[model samples]
Target: MFLVYVDESGDTGLVNSPSNYFCLSAIVVHESHWQTTLNSVIGFRKELRASYGFKLREEIHCSHFIHKPGDFQRIPKSLRLRLLRDVIDFQASLLNYQIVNMVVNKKNKSLNSDIFSLAWQTLIQRIENTLYHHNFIGSNNATDSALLFVDKTDEIKLRNLTRRMRRYNPVPNSFNLGSGYRMMPTQWVIEDAIHRDSAHSYFI
Candidate 1:
């Protein structure tokens, strides 16, 4: 089994929104490596605590940290930038993990466009494709399944979207004779996405 953790950046709103893009990112880790990955993360957090006075339980919200909002105001801007770079480096060093990201440019989209749903659909489709082709870790050729853990945002909407996709996901068949799409219902992802508060989940 694979454990997928998902999070989003930027608001879904288009009008008067500060950012023009909304992004969804997922980190995939095999069940066998979950514990090791968690341990590594905890170790990294501990190092942060010891070296920079960053609390272990403190959630690392990039925007808030960068903007020096609330408690983050106490930390130096230069140190925050360094910490962000450390995070990227640590993530890069992790083994048996894959990161998938989907960004929606809302510049061309209508104000009424459902940015959240569109971004999630594209992100989930990419994740499903990755699972289909490379489900297993290492030399194991047997296919594996995955469960998604998304940061709690729009639970009802996201759940409905995931459930619907599992039933009737269609993808364009580029190799077909004409403009055609094929049914590719999600088979490897099990059940609806389990929502978790990002505050509690360090991975989120």
Candidate 2:
């Protein structure tokens, strides 16, 4: 089994919105190393707290930590750079993990459906492709099942979208116009929708 933890950045609103881009990011981890990965993340957070006086309870959002002037602002520039560099290093050191990101430019074209839903559709397609590749390439240890975990902030909306995708194909007919009889990948997703609060979702 594998776990695909997802989180999004930016609002779906296009009018009077601050962000120009919306992104859906998923961190895929195999079941065998799940506990170790969780522990390593917790330990990294603890290290940050001890060494940099960073708050453990606060989430490590990239934009807020790097661009905005708040919690990380009080720290020296050199230290901030060091902390971020170390974080990148730690992420690179992880084994059997994959980070998949889908970024959309909200202003590029008019969307047929809500931006959030479209983003989810694209994300699911990418995930399905990953699973398909894995099943074919890693035949000896092919993944049998996978679960998706999303931030609980938009639980209702996310759950509704998941249910809709599971019940019927959401991909537009226009997408498959060129490819004959190509099925969309949403069916591979598990029906149960799991939501976790970002405050406690360290692995996400």
Candidate 3:
């Protein structure tokens, strides 16, 4: 089994929006390595607490951390940059997980386009394809089932989209001679995505 943690950046709005692109990122970790991976993250957070007086439970919002907003104001800019670099290095050092990311350019999209749905659909398809081919841990034949945990920003919309896809997802039939799509219901992912508050869940 695998646990998939998902988060998004930017807004779905195409007009007068702060960002022109929307990105969805997923971190996939196998069941066998989940505990060790979590322990490593907790250890890293403890290191931050000891070195910079950062709280272990404090959520690390990238924008606020970089901009030094609110509670982050006391942290010097130079230390913030160093901390960011350390985070990058730590993430790079992890070997038991996979990162899947999808970005939608809203600049060229129509005003009526559903940017959120499109981005999630593509991302889910990519994840499904990956799991179908490789769902093993070392020599063990683990179950290919995966569970998704997303930041609770659009619970209803995301749940509906995921449920619909599980029922009747379609994909291009590359093996066919003609241009046609084929039903490809989700196989690896189980049930609707479980939403969580990012502030509460360190994994999110």
Candidate 4:
């Protein structure tokens, strides 16, 4: 079975504000690989702490390192930059995994807005193709389930708008690991628990 996780970035309200440019990030992996991937990242973080005693999650006094606070800052800037460059250079050796990402340019407006849905459609079409063609995923399977980790900073706004579109509320911030779509707050302590398993699974 295929496990899909999603997340979103940027504000869901007015575009002229400081947090403009709404982005939705998603990372889907085969269920078979879920535990393997999560365990790997978790183990790596522990090694970092043991080897150098470098406090990874500075914000919280926790030991299980899947979603440690300040992990974005903790990871060496050089490594982050390298991935950006190596990823584009067709450097398979450097890529962490095969993934796809889509973003709604809120410079124009909210995703549910008429203008934004145009762009949103294209993003969905691409994702549909990716999921269909993935060998590990196997699209011919009659049943499919998708998960979403939406950044509802504009909870009141997005929920109302999306309900109008989907005819119901998408999902709430009840994160059941990879069992179902988790609508979570975009805070470190909360968002970090999802980092390694479905790190970019913010939106669908």
User: What CA RMSD would you report for each candidate?
Assistant: 1.8, 3.2, 1.9, 12.1
Candidate with top lDDT is: 1
lDDT against the true structure, each candidate: 0.86, 0.75, 0.85, 0.42
Residue 6, model 3: lDDT of: 95
What TM-score does candidate 4 get on C-alpha atoms?
Answer: 0.47
Candidate 3, residue 41: how far the Cα is off, in Å: 0.4
lDDT of 4 by residue, 1-204 (tens): 455454555544563556656555555555555676666545555654564454435322222233333554555655444433432453233222345566655565544575334333333434444544543243454444333344333345433443343332233334554455433212111111122322332112
Q: For residues 1-204, write the lDDT of model 3, one tens digit per residue.
A: 788999999989988999999999899888889899899999999998887777888887778887645787778877877877888899999878888999999999998999999999999988888878884332245456889999966888888888998889988878655788989998888888988888877778
Better of 2 and 4 by TM-score: 2
Q: Which ten residues in a row have the lowest lDDT in candidate 1?
A: 134-143
lDDT of 1 by residue, 1-204 (tens): 888899989889988999999998888888888888899999999999887788999988788887645887777888888888898999999888888889999999997899998998888888778778875453264578788999968989998988999889887887654688989888878888989998899889
Deviation in Å, model 3, residue 105 alpha carbon:
0.6
Residue pairs with colliding backbones in model 4 are: 5-201, 6-149, 6-201, 6-202, 6-203, 7-201, 7-202, 7-203, 67-192, 173-183
Better of 3 and 4 by TM-score: 3
**Where does candidate 3 clash, by residue pair?**
none
Model 2, 1-204: lDDT tens digits are: 778899888878788779998888888887777898888988988999888877878777666666784867887767777777888898998776788899988997475537887887778767776775674221246544568988854667777776766656544455647634444536556756588887888876
Q: In model 1, what are the clashing residue pairs, if there are any?
A: none
TM of each candidate vs. truth: 0.92, 0.83, 0.92, 0.47
Q: Which regions of candidate 3 fall more than 4 Å away from where they truly are? A: 135-142, 174-178
